[model samples]
Target: MPSVEATGAKLYFEESGYGYPIIFIHEFASDMRGWDAQIGHFSRSYRCIAYNARGYPPSDVPEDPQSYGWELAVDDIAALMRHLDIEQAHLIGLSMGGYAALQFGLRYPERVGAIVAGSVGSGCHPAHRDAWLRETSVPSRIFVEHGMVTMAERMARGPARVQLKYKDRQRWREFILRLRQHSPQGMAKTMAHCQAARPSLHDLSHQLSDMAIPVLLAVGDEDTRCLETNLMLKSELPNAGLWICPNTGHAINLEEPAAFNAQVENFLGAVERGSWLRGFPATATIPSLVRSRGARRDHSLIQIDQETEGADVVRLHLR
Candidate 1:
């Protein structure tokens, strides 16, 4: 097994093909294998690297509960890149992985060529932060008490994930099998430390607005937990383009692999050609629900509803 020593643990990673580097980061519920669909397609055209974050097996599972967290996860990405001698690479992450990729760009702006974050924010909303923290902690107990078997049973059918079950039962079953393989201790610590405690994206507006790296913020329209914050990300990130997979939910990359691959491929090509330029700043148009009263710069809502292949897509259009 190919692995890199990072932070206090060894991260197991897989690599293939040869071209501009692209690193795949997995969600909390997944390990490096979650990116198999992407790795197969992208490795043909890019140097695809996928790694298991610390605590995921084949990777060391640190015993200290405090060892796992959002910051540590970002550190693992930086460490992996440095060990691989990659100064910069395109980052593709989903769910918890999405959160890490976004933060990686913020913390290491100079080392990011581009970012494609799917279903990035779920429990980071301002209006429900406390509730999210409480809810996120509940899973830690469930994982420690009832174990991974119970986790796969519930998480696979979560509101944002059920779309995968409905769209492709076989794939969903594969997802469950993978989930079952994860360490219950790892999942518990992740929920308690990383998911429950990472800084809210809404709190990083200025830093997000200043980042010039091309970003593709992809999310499913029915992933209601992430929609508001995705809108916030679009409003703040200068070089971001939002893509909402209509009639879809979370596990988007799995539920709609072809669309996900195509959108990412197109975005990468555009960025390479210098066609994916920054969008106009919209700090003045932050939604009241998304921004603090003290941070408000504008008051009107500017939604641009678009249709591609007949599915309604909502986009921000500040003027």
Candidate 2:
């Protein structure tokens, strides 16, 4: 409904359900309503929280691009978690949200119980960014510099196909139109931050291994944006599980909510049973999850081994 002040800007957010806490973050140009399906499903057993990040609809729009950087966005999340007294929450983010969540988890490891990062690769890979810059940059810059409809032709491609498959032409049109209304400058700033503050989880690999927190990494099989990145990440994140959804795209959460929710539900169940966390209860030592791995030391980088369980084999390199 209404937004709250986390740091300086107003962030729109909604809370629903009534069990273990789960916070959902939306992608660029989209708001908390993106989680409508997830809230409906997960609210039945888990407390679901979805929020609009700064510079999005129903949220404050800061003029300075610096104000909307990824690190700042990550800080906004951390502040919100503290403001809401959410000690530990399962972090679920898509695309830009994924990058923000990763930064938040690295900064406030104690406050995160588990993490589900979709449609985002291990941050800052040159090839990944290059591809994104080509396919996404023009549209992003057009939308930001000129106007929303500058690339309406391009934006319609994915949403149009989605409408055909589901027979929801009217709804699809509205969704795309709403995304078009987003501040072009704001969206550009968000993208710039994502590219500039890109983080490497490689150094944190061993730290993650020791944390043993349940992590589920997912990407659309056809999503050229983050598929290989996720594959690379699966190898480094020791306790992480990977899923590649078929017939999907970069916007997998919106394009395939059923599969997305199922992956989240399964991981949450494992978390409850302490199977994924290796008997290390979330409340007992979440901060310790990242800390237990101790200092970083030189270690051989692990490579992808083979394909297993629908995901590529990832070798875990512990330092």
Candidate 3:
């Protein structure tokens, strides 16, 4: 009853509050419950929805690997919204879910109000394509062979995730506990069909360039795997702004929920007021400057300046 049918599987979902919708999608290692911090905060002002992907428990896991794919994840979001009678909603996702949010923005611009993508672009660097594929694909075999228990042990000690362990032991334990509960078959299918097979963000330059949706890209300074890719995302997406959290790692939201919530709340406000990017996007202005014929923009649409010690913490708002 709390599940919706997608192409080849059923997705279990949860909804809270009552306002303009906000859908929270999870990362590869996480499930719908992973968004508890976000949903708990945003639900006070917005209709918040979170769901377990097709492979996660309570959601049907089709035996057919054909049942899962990267694009299908976006389709699932659309299907979920349609099933709920929602024409459009804001999308907030972390890692894999972040990629899905961007893809959904590209595919159905009409269906998205805005996008907040955190710690996205892991294997998107051109040079890392082959290696990233190998890295991502290997997890499928590992998951299928040793099971989630062993996989969880290995992943809990990952370089980027160590920050979580040191920063919040209890939280890190919670993450690992949930990870161990995942189905090996579902995880294997997900790693193989969804993550390993997904297209690189660099390859989507044209679509990203043409995308007019407002985007907020968040990453961690210690998340070396994603820094370059997030930079690329900022460059390719016209109305994109980026924030780099100093000393943080892969899981930006989980690592810094307080800061994350505050920043996202401000971004959502800006989006609602139609002031996120204002009239002229920075990318559009560059060409305008090259032409040097058009009148300069008198009003400040968006301002970019480094306030904190970290220059990568990009903060944008109408002045």
TM-score of 3: 0.88
* Rank list by lDDT: 3, 1, 2
Off by over 4 Å in 2: 130-140, 158-171, 195-197, 200-211, 277-319
**Where does candidate 1 stray beyond 4 Å?**
279-319
What would the per-residue lDDT of candidate 2 be over residues 4-122, giving only the tens digit for each residue? 77665788788988988998988774677777888999999988888888877678777776676767788888777876788899999987788677667767777888899887763
Error of 1 at 263 (Å): 0.3
State the C-alpha lDDT per candidate: 0.88, 0.69, 0.88
lDDT of 3 by residue, 231-283 (tens): 99888888888999999998788889999999899998999997776333242
Residue 283 accuracy (lDDT) in model 3: 27
Output the TM-score of candidate 1.
0.87
Any runs in candidate 3 off by more than 4 Å, and if so which? 278-319
lDDT of 1: 0.88
Q: List the residue pairs that clash in candidate 3.
A: none
Better of 1 and 2 by lDDT: 1
